[model samples]
Target: MQQCKLPSRQKGFSLIELMVGMTIGLILVAGLALMFANSSQSGNELEKSIRQIENGRYAVELLQEEISLAGYYAEIPLHGIAYSSPAACETSALGFSLTTLPMPIMGIAASNVSEICLTDRLANSPAFVIHRLSAEGAPSNPASAALGTTYVQSSRCSADGVPFKAATAGSASAFDLKAIDCATTNPQIRRYVSRVYYLASCSECGSVSDGIPTLKMAELRGTTMVVAPLVEGIENMVLEYGFDTNADGQPDVFQTNLSTTAGADKWDNVVAVRLHLLARTIDRSADYSDSSKTYQLGAASTVSGDASGFKRRVYTSTVRIVNEAGRRETVSYKPASSP
Candidate 1:
């Protein structure tokens, strides 16, 4: 018993071995952490790219939707309306009068009209206005119409008004145009639509300089123009209008400014519009490089140097003025006279 047992033979690792193992474990953990960080960074970059693309597409689509409705006054667009040049910041009754009703679309190449409802418009970007009738059916009769809101009603009967009726008073006499069969008792109305779309240089700096560019709208709400910001990261926008010189609804020439383009001031003859939007990521990406790229936007080209760190892409859309072009689509074959 006293002899007892042999000394316990348990072997322990040396301090060097323990230190080595810990070092390897630390190295593996560090590598994994680095990998995770890179993955997270990539994910962020992808998200930014997707957001940029979405914003660009949405901006283009919104513009197209508004443009399609240009010159759309229900059944009649130019019954007796004359082509008139729109002045900057003109939103009064005189601006929307029947005499100048033919101007459904207007565009400015430079930010010359900076005093318009939108002063934050970006320089070198295009601003355009669209005039149309609301797609929704307004009050059935002028007496039931909303007070202070302008409405346009098309006359199906030639006995009433030749084309349509435009009114704001909530009285029966306001609506002179009637429905088919000269049903003066029952009249359909459409709300007036006026919208100005432009690129604004405002951002979350607290800001649009170090801030992201945004697509903004100055819409005619009641008697005043209400400005609202829409899509973000829209760096710039350029537009060209397709003019129907022969009145056949087909575009014969594309021009930049509707006011000063060659064979100019034909607002009613515009059949199509081509738009180019330059969009960018809201945040600068360290991985992106565009030093060699020069963006071509409509009639203007971007400056060659790209020192801005934000990633950018261009979006283009060509939209036909449905209400303007569709009415001119009638095919008439002229037969030889009684030969």
Candidate 2:
């Protein structure tokens, strides 16, 4: 009867049915595309963060290595000492001072004036010379000999003792001497020369005049050497002196800058140093600017304005210059019986 004609049951799907099926398929495809896009973005961001962290960590390690070695060969004579010229040399410019002994003990009397120098013998000719001055402080112009006394002429020698000149003609405030008069009767004056060198960033970096930024180590002897780049993004480096004044205990003077005029006296009591470094990222990433997003380092700090879009980070560390001589002397003295 009406049997088969059941209206061919519309052999194919109705337009409405087809439209619904198509819509469902489109939704699934769109969702998959969105997921893939999100995954890719997340991966890129993760990679960028890891890189930044690695850079920062590397910089910190480098600084620690150098700073830990501050006054490495010798101990800081005092916490803080004013860079004032000797009363007799009043007209002379004041200078800061520190002391240290030579790496090798050749039995040379520390008194014998041997120029405090850095042997770049490892490098080519032109080794650096660090002159030990018998002055109260560093003169404004090191070139002027009137400011201080040129005690020793430090020369760069090979393992064989061959002397070499440094490329530049300058002096180093710090030094490594062969010997010091530890038995001196004068308690105020330190027998050993304090070789103090401040490792800081010079005007060379970021300056149109000085090609690229480099790590520089300056010594009281009037020598400056551009060492290898410790880290790329280092913006500024500062060193503070902490002194343990008064035999009673604890350091007293905390000065940001060291004076050439004043020997260790500026911080003669300084037993420790507080080092600070301001570093920035060499490569900036766009993802970091998003306000809604956060990184492992926390809220991203931009350079200057939104335009420059640079990021900066800072780190700090403190180091103590142990008195090797003091330790040794203490070990030698067993609280001698009152005579």
Candidate 3:
């Protein structure tokens, strides 16, 4: 009886073994869906290349810390003294000054504007402008001026500079006619940092329809300039100065068009600052394709269009104008009358 029944057992799955077990379970489910779509496109291209190298090294360390604080005019006196007035701080409404040659950095190349220092260039790309003289306040006084956030200090003879905050609280004769002789004793407040650094199409990570290519700056605050939006796939920003064209302090050539009515004395012989930037990756990369690649920038410029399909990185830096090459090789023209 057992022998007869056993032969009938093969009647269950024999349609060629159910088509080879359904073609090996549909080829192991299409090889696990192509290895989970290539590991989710390599984890979205390593998280968009680590957010484009952390937004291009935080926009090249925030323009190398504002280009080493360009011409930080803190000690105040900038060469020979004889001033009757006007060192002009307190957001000089953008006319900043420590008295010439402290040009403290400036640029414009790439659609070549024409104007140099005080805003208005930045057309197709490249930009700069630093100035400096901030980070040192709190002393306050002059009737506690505080309109746009007061800042002024004078006494000890005074030379001028530090007048903004709605004329140090609306009229002390317009804050001693724009700072410097506040006479409230040795007060000493300070705050005036000019910035600039361009490259915009707007994008702090949203808005402007996310065309993403930010990096913008501006900043002044008092009389108001304020731009903001820093770093976000910073698409481009050339800037090449370098200069010292022979005054010695270092740096020899590198230009990229200067301004303020042409080379404005090569912007105090710049001293150093090459920076290139470029950075990109605001998404868009089916698996990469910088279209034959090019991306030049500093060696006389490049990067024109069709930036492939995202994912880029250039970032460079030369930076060194540390307070104009850390000056003071014996130049103090005054202040010795009281030891």
Candidate 4:
């Protein structure tokens, strides 16, 4: 009955209200997108960092193991055996027989070409060489061994050691222990190892185009020496030798460069080695840059970061040759007793 004049029902939101609501919604969506993008980028960077660390640590351990084994030749003292000259020592691209001159551990200086031990040196980077008996250790001759397997026979146990000719397809299995002479029994017949660790050109791999570097080693494979990649993202390597110059059996001097002629006298005096490695991320950083950063590898070595946008780190270790040091304690200099 009462036709009350009700307020006109609003048909829909006004144009201005609709626009304001749309703008607010857009702003919220934009904020969420920005957060998600940042989180994804951070995750990618973390993954890269972890990969680099793993590779760097693995590479260093590989080198350390080999370096520690340098100069080890069963129980026989390699340094005690003297050759007529360096030529009598078997030589190869990757390795040479350890000589009396202490060639078990050799180095190439970064700056001086004349100080290099390796015939071909990598420019502006130092490298090191190591020689030792294979890690398989001295194994009794197998009934039939693989082509690359190393074996050892030593009289250190019972009778004189057995002597066998170089491994061949035919000779690998057919050695007559009865035919071997008693005087030749002590001969140490084991797989020999000569390895050179260095930074190598990565163009063959995908890294060079991507600005990444690689660590490589030349090791004896059968009768041939082959070079293979050890790790990626390694930028540089620096080495120093610690010498027992005073015959005290303790390191009295540490030097980066040693010449065969001038420093030949001190080569056999090497007791320990210092290793420095520079590692970098494989991918460039989108937000961060590496330019203008100088990394210190050791007391005397420092490398500047490039303009490329990548992160880097330095790894270092000082390793002592137990085989060498253990034998030298007889002549080791004991510090004078202080009252």
lDDT for each candidate structure:
0.76, 0.37, 0.63, 0.64
lDDT of 3 by residue, 1-339 (tens): 455544544458879999999999999999999999999989988999998999899889878877877876565545552112112222454443233322566665556555333232234876766765565455455555556643433324434443222233455553442233444444444554556667766464343256677777766665666676777777777777777644547777777776534342456667678888889888788646776777887988887546457878788888887767666233447767875
User: lDDT (0-100) at residue 296 of candidate 3?
Assistant: 85
Against the true structure, candidate 4 has what lDDT?
Answer: 0.64
Please state every model's RMSD to the true fold in angstroms. 3.8, 14.7, 17.2, 5.6
In terms of lDDT, the best-performing candidate is: 1
Pairs that collide in candidate 3 are none
Q: How far is 58's C-alpha from truth in model 3 (Å)?
A: 5.1
State the weakest 10-residue window (summed lDDT) of model 4.
Answer: 83-92
Model 4 TM-score (2 dp)? 0.76
lDDT of 1 at 319: 95
lDDT for residue 53 in candidate 4, whole number 0-100: 96
- List where candidate 4 sits over 4 angstroms from the true fold: 1-10, 77-79, 83-102, 110-122, 137-142, 148-152, 157-189, 206-211, 262-265, 331-339
TM-score of every prediction relative to native = 0.86, 0.44, 0.36, 0.76
Backbone collisions counted per model? 6, 82, 0, 5
Q: For residues 52-145, what per-residue lDDT tens digits would candidate 2 score against the true structure?
A: 5566667567545443343332222333322222211111221333332232101112122232232211111111112222334432232333
**Superposition error at 34 for model 2 (Å):** 2.9
How big is the positional error of residue 76 in model 4, measured in Å on the Cα after superposition?
2.7
Candidates ranked, most accurate by TM-score first:
1, 4, 2, 3
